[model samples]
Target: MARKMLIDGEVAAVADGGHYDYDLFVIGAGSGGVRGSRTAASFGAKVAICELPFHPISSEWLGGHGGTCVIRGCVPKKILVYGASFRGEFEDSKNFGWEINGDINFNWKTLLENKTKEIVRLNGVYQRILTSAGVTMIEGAGSLVDAHTVEVSQPDGSKQRYTAKHILIATGSRAQRVNIPGKDLAITSDEALSLEELPKRAVILGGGYIAVEFASIWRGMGAEVDLFYRRDLPLRFVINFRESLLLLIL
Candidate 1:
């Protein structure tokens, strides 16, 4: 027998009066998944969200609560950029008759360590937010078992299953390496953020924001950067007016 279920104001036929472990089960605890699950829980829906274990460098089996933006993407990149921008700041300070006493040195280890600490702290904060919101936080990789069921594989070779009235697959995107020879030799933005030592020289291949941003970052940090792109100009899809600014910055 089938009964109509009202979900998000939509009526759909489901198994009549079927029992569910949660009202909503989200398969990824990335930004999208976390936001959706938290919102659903706020609305009195019993929500459970599953994510892979915490890791700055994401893999198929390892992602954290706050997703790419917080864990490895924007936050870390911005922190590095802020650190690199000090060089220009120091130079500009010279124009204001501010004389520096000693040789200015950038400590890569200290910055890297602090950045990692901030990331870990934010991970804990996200967990606390979920706990406060009444969203069950499950640490594992989740897979769809059926339309209304999810199976999670834990870190210790254990699996758990849960049924839900509605399932949300908010698994985020992953960076794809180009299908070229020696692709494995190239590091994605993920690895670029967590480099043990600052690069002395870097060659970036691509015209997207990531490539341009890295080029600027490395160059600002005193690395020789060469950017290669297939298009006549990098960021061809960006607004025409911003092209000149990007050119000057890069």
Candidate 2:
């Protein structure tokens, strides 16, 4: 039996009767999966999506709605970009001869609060977009039970089985969150986006965009910053010529 759902002012149905089949089944709610599902739904296909449980780190079994990119990666990273961009704005303000006051201290809490609020708001908007598109948003981790069949472990510990004409997986990549002493204490970009305070000193530990952006942000806000990258050269515009000429997954 297919379910019935409404999108925008129109209506789309997945199962109007009993247990129903879907034209498309999506695993993970990242940008690609959701976008594909929505586009398919818009074309009058019955679509369903399964999202894993939420965690600071993303994985097939321990992911959340909006996938890694939304909950932990792209969204958070872009927010940091927005935060870092304020420095340029302030510089421009100075160039415009808007010299006004005393020492301007950085307030990390304000941006953090607003970031949290915006993420929540975007999450809701994502949900609404799916619902309005008549796409089924399943909350759980999906597994390939058999050919053409997918089994989902829901948040409440229940299991659901679905058969679909097509299945899409778009979980996106996870950060290389390391494990070591105080590793758990270290903040990923997810938390960095909502930092409570701009530390007087910061030691960045990766060659990734998140690390570099934080370095820029903290330094811009008058914090001492030490950036450490594994490679001899920084990631930006660096090229290497190695002897090995072959690398293929297949």
Candidate 3:
């Protein structure tokens, strides 16, 4: 006999009502999954969210909380940019009657360590948020076995099956590299955020916002940056090449 229940303002039929584990099972703990699960739980639905182990550099088996935008995408990138921007600030302060003495050197190790500490702290904060929301947080990868069944694989290769009336998939997206020769030697944005040392020279590919942002970041930190783009104009033709004003003239 099929059992029916109301979920998210909709009626859903289940094969076994008494045997089901949760009302809502969410895959991926990224922003979407977290928001969806929290919302569902707020509506009095039993929710369980699954995600991989915490890692700054993500892969199929390891992804931290808060997904790409919070973890590797925006948060870390902005931190680096802010750290690099200090160079301009220090130089500008000299013109404002602030006497600057000695060579102003940026320490890559110190910045990387502090950024990592902040990220790890935020990861714990996200977990606490889920705990407070009453959502079950399972550390693993989730896959759909059926319309109402989800299979979660833990880090130790063990798996658990949970049946829910509704399931949400929000694993998020991964960065793709250009299929060129020696592509493996190139690093993606994820690795760029946690680099141990700043490179003296950097050649960035693409003409998008990310590429331009990184070029500015490195250039601000005193690196020789060369950006390559296929389009006639950089940044989708919104900003001209010469008048882009990447270099900070202090």
Each prediction's TM-score versus the true structure: 0.90, 0.74, 0.90
Candidate 1 C-alpha lDDT tens digits along 171-242: 988777999999999999999999999899999999888898898789998999999999878877786855
RMSD after Cα superposition, model 2: 8.1
Q: Rate the local accuracy (lDDT) of all candidates.
A: 0.86, 0.70, 0.84
**What 10-residue stretch in candidate 1 is worst by lDDT?**
1-10
RMSD of each: 3.7, 8.1, 3.7
Best-to-worst ranking by TM-score: 1, 3, 2
The parts of candidate 2 lying over 4 Å away from their true place are: 1-20, 53-65, 87-95, 179-185, 236-250
| Candidate 2 structure quality by residue, lDDT tens digits, 80-166 | 667767777887898899895886655677776666666666667788888999999888878887655789886577898988756
* Residue pairs with clashing backbones, model 1: none
Model with the higher TM-score, candidate 1 or 2: 1
lDDT at 65, model 3: 84
lDDT of 3: 0.84
What tens-digit string does per-residue lDDT give for candidate 3 at 196-218?
88989999989888998899899
